[model samples]
Target: MVNLLLENGDLVVIEQSDFQQLLDVLAERTYQVVGPTIRDSAIIYDEMTSYTKLPIGWTDVQGKGTYRLKRREDDALFGYTVGPHSWKKYLHPPVSYLWRTNTTADGFQVTTAIEEPPKLAFIGVRACELQAIAAQDQVFLQGRFVDADYKARRENIFVVAVNCVQAGGTCFCASLKTGPKATSGFDLALTEVLTGTNHYFLVEIGSSAGADVMQAVTHQPASPAQIEAAEALVEATTQQMGRTLEPLDLKELLYNSYEHPQWDELGERCLGCGSCTMVCPTCFCTTTHDTIDVTGETTAHSKKWDSCFTMTFSYIHGGNVRTPLRSRYRQWLMHKFATWLDQFGRSGCVGCGRCITWCPAYIDITEEIRAIQESTNKQEEKIGGKL
Candidate 1:
């Protein structure tokens, strides 16, 4: 809690010194501030106490089989891109206890689980990652079998999204129409604008809670030049992206490429390491397990995150369904771009490009899609010749 004072005026144009007030305001409301911090040589989401914890003036270079943090020329709080961690780490945790039971001498009764969710305030969230959280909401909260833990956590979220000022080497959110700008599903959205001798955020109010938080900080009305500068920076980021995924007709294109040889090609490169699923914000598969004490006096049931890349993920009584690497890869790709539409009415991938950057084998999904499309075109050409 850094000491900073604001005068009696409209709190709209906040300065860097006043940023700490925003966290203090959330803390006063009993909302724990969870945000990005540089650890393990990567920017990760963790419990943040002050503005000093933010990775200021740091951006990252991300590509297939590559990632490195680099210092920026100017001081900007939200200049960096996303890392291996996503908001789902808090909203939908990797592990949680379902319920526990203790045996009684006379009789036994099942003890159900009831855990209250935390009041969370997420800082420095990106637009594509926000879209990823919305997609996860459809999986956990909107479905018939609502995940109680996820629902509890989702209900109490307060998001502070940041628009991208610089695109990473593997970024493609523009192609997926998901990012470079914060559009919706955020409480407060900010675009960091840094001009010569001027650095400020063009803040946009998205929710009542956001407005309440704004009251705690000191701000002034933004000039038209500032707003235009913000827009220009976002457009620059969009144009500087390192990859692209064609969104038009993507569903049908993937759906019809079931037998594409690219699946076999990528299967050879894919390590089945589950890195993509672990980094992906939208991958929400889980498996539950029960643990009993040695004396059998108590039992505990818990659920944790799982991945389709595992052979046992599709296991049945007989054996694994997707045993082969090719089949497993096909299932993952097709489900993300094809069948996910039929199930969720939207593409599962938000084009965050974590799968492309963090992969040990450099297995790029965009390249796979391109190969499939080329193969499809060749087959169509052959058919035309036959006709």
Candidate 2:
């Protein structure tokens, strides 16, 4: 172990062996280290005990409504892009027990669910995913009512972010300025460099915790040339994106094109299965349910992840506000691009492209946005001609 004190903004290089030791060090600190692993023919985030469990030499091919795993030419862990699972599953959980109520001799008594939050150290987090985590923080932390569960889980997290060296077929983070390289929101960021007969990682310390962890691992200061090489790889990744979203007047476009025909066309292709929302890292909507006993003396309330695509999501006293499938689709898309900025200060999407990859009906949001732009342009052209 190197006995040097590490600090934020420091760049270091760790060989493959030291990289594995980094995992051991984090685990020794009593953190539940979660990372990307091959499971059921797909890369998913799960409890990773050893570095060998990583998806080494395996990459994923993704497209609208399709995903597959392929073997890489060399053994390079963290070679793949974002998969169907996101970090939100751990932070916000699929379901949470809120509280329980029981009738006593005098009156009703309530017991709020309280438990210790797990100390988690996430590995292989991408840049766009970091932005997604920040977006959720805005929703659950900075909002009027802070989410106790989200806060408890988020406060103790140790993030190990990965800089993307290759772009996925569905990725467009470069266009959104959310990724290809992680800039913040992590304890440590890694850029993998695998050359002939050489394999190593260029690590960036973003926080003191990351620096402390590095003290236990064997590493050396990265040379300027090594840093440049890592940067060149990230630049190449930015250019390799299979999709791109031009962020010009997007909020205004969605807000103004409320009745655009492109939405109806999208409705015909969208399956409303909620797969996109489930895979999206930044989507945070949820619904609560209560269970009552036959005697009506006890009740248990719980919350589960929900989506605006569901018909029941917009249900109210009289009926569902978004009855039509087109309306539901419009609501979801508009919220991400338009209303979300009004609610929060930023766009909801981080451009990870999981939604495009997981959509069973092959709906591509970037293409949809382009179509809306074209339609708006044509409509304006006709109006200008009349004038």
Candidate 3:
């Protein structure tokens, strides 16, 4: 693999063919290749063979609370923003069997479940996703109670981050200070460069493992002009986001606006179907249950994704604290924008906009924040008038 400095001064370039070959080599080494593909007219992550399965000439139109697919002028793989799915599907599965129990002469015997970590090569991961992974790392890996299952899978995974060349209308990653360019927590990073004369990807190695993969591929040294083009592409995407969040002190804003009227407005339209939490990359709440087969002799316990919007989520001994729809809505928003930072040292929402797009009622978080800001301004005006 040829390595040359690009104009960005921080990036390196590898030929597109070389990048494709590297995936083949990783698969040969027992990595399950995961990347973006066109599924049901939207870009979703799935197992891929080579680069042919990637979403080509596909881009998404995202708004405050809408998403649509549109054709692109050229066949550029990884051309779209995130869809309903994220890398969490593979890293942390929807449902997993923790263990099993069997009836025995002595009563019952429990067998602990053993999981073998699958070596994974995640292709086309975006900057915000990398940040989400890092945030989850703090929760599952570094906490007092470490999740063995999550730890095993995380250790065997390899990340390949892609600098976003296009932004969705619902995206506020720039306002959240998360994306448009990958900063860390990846093995390799790629920037897709498409120009009038040349179409290639500028690659950069983030670790020794990525460097080894680069060595096996055939590549030519990247020129400075190519690097500049890639940087410009990322910059343009950052500027193109359709939605923006005000630069408010999130912690103070949420803490003080506990009775904001926006929550009541959202509660009326919200179905509380939990679709937003299901599609969100960072919502990790879960519930457990035990089920018996028709025979009644065999039983299994399972855990599945859960959300704060549900009535049972806030259940106490005899009643639920957040019984009202407005309270549930406020809990969700406050947890995401305020308490999560205190608990996890990061915002729970990654600004991916999946919640906005997937919500049937089209509730936009950015717009909600702006409404709160407007309300706060009016409240301050009334206090001044009283004085």
Candidate 4:
């Protein structure tokens, strides 16, 4: 092992073999190392005991309501874009118990389930994903009422970010300034450099923990040439994005288009299956459930992910509010692009584009927003003509 003290923001180069050793080191330190792996014909995050488990020599093709896995020309591990899964699945789990009540001998006892959060080492996190995690941090941790479970899981994780060298067919992170290159929010960031007969990773240490991990790996300070090569690769990827969104005053646009006919058009196409929310990294809405045993002596209360697309999501004592599919769809899009800013002081979208790729109806958020803009402009022109 090449032992050396490394400071935050220091860039280093490590051979592909040494990258495997880094995974071994994390395992030795008792971290449940999870990363992207080919599973069920998709790149999903799961327990990866070896570096070889990474989606090596494989990339994905994504489009509106379409996704597939294909082989890459070279053995590049981190060559793909974000897939159906996000890091939120681990940090803010789909299901968890809040508390439970039971009929005890004397009286009813309400007890909370105390489970230790896993010490997770997340590998292959993309740039937009880092922003998604940050957005969730604001919702669960920085809010007035902090979620204890999310906080516990978030505080005990190590992030290994990967810079994208190629954009997916549905990606628009460049427009949102959320990715194509990871700037922060990672313990270590990696840029894969693949030259003929050479393969290495440009690793950036972003925290003391990352530097400590580097001490056990065989690596050296990257030369000026190597650093320049890595930067050029990321710079070129910026122009290769498959889609782009005009980062205009989207908040004001959505706020004013509340009664626009575009909602009805989208409602006709949207399946209301909630696939988009399930795949989205920043959409965090949940509902609670109570499970009781046969004797009704024990009751377990648990929370699971929910979606505004569901009619029951806005249900009240009288009946399900937002009964029309148009209203439900309108509420979802408006909340994401408008009300979210008022609530979190930032846009909820990170431009990962999973929602576009996973939608069965081929619905695209960028396209929908553009349609709204066009409709509004046409209405203004018509009124001006009358004037």
In model 3, residue pairs whose N, Cα or C atoms come closer than 3 Å (at least 3 residues apart or on different chains), thus clashing, are none
> Which candidate has the highest lDDT of all?
2
Off by over 4 Å in 3: 3-10, 385-387
**TM-score winner, 3 or 4:** 4
Q: State the C-alpha lDDT per candidate.
A: 0.85, 0.92, 0.82, 0.91
Residues 1-387, model 3: lDDT tens digits:
444422322356665555678688788778899999888877889988778888778899876456788999987777888998988887777886677677777787777664787889999999989888888888888878998888889999888899999888788789888897998988888899876656688887787777666656665666889888888999999998867886558778889988777888988988888888888888888888777777665667777778999999989999999988888888888888999889987788888888888988878888888889888888899999999
* Collision pairs in model 4: none
Backbone clash count, each prediction separately = 2, 0, 0, 0
What order do candidates take by TM-score, descending?
4, 2, 1, 3
C-alpha lDDT of candidate 3 relative to the true structure: 0.82
What TM-score does candidate 1 get on C-alpha atoms? 0.95
Poorest 10 consecutive residues by lDDT, candidate 1: 1-10
RMSD of 2: 1.4
* Tens digits of lDDT, candidate 1, 179-204: 98888898888888777877777777
- Residue 345 in model 4: lDDT: 91
C-alpha TM-scores of all predictions: 0.95, 0.97, 0.94, 0.97
Of 1 and 3, the candidate ahead on lDDT is 1
Which residue runs does candidate 1 get wrong by more than 4 Å? 1-11, 385-387
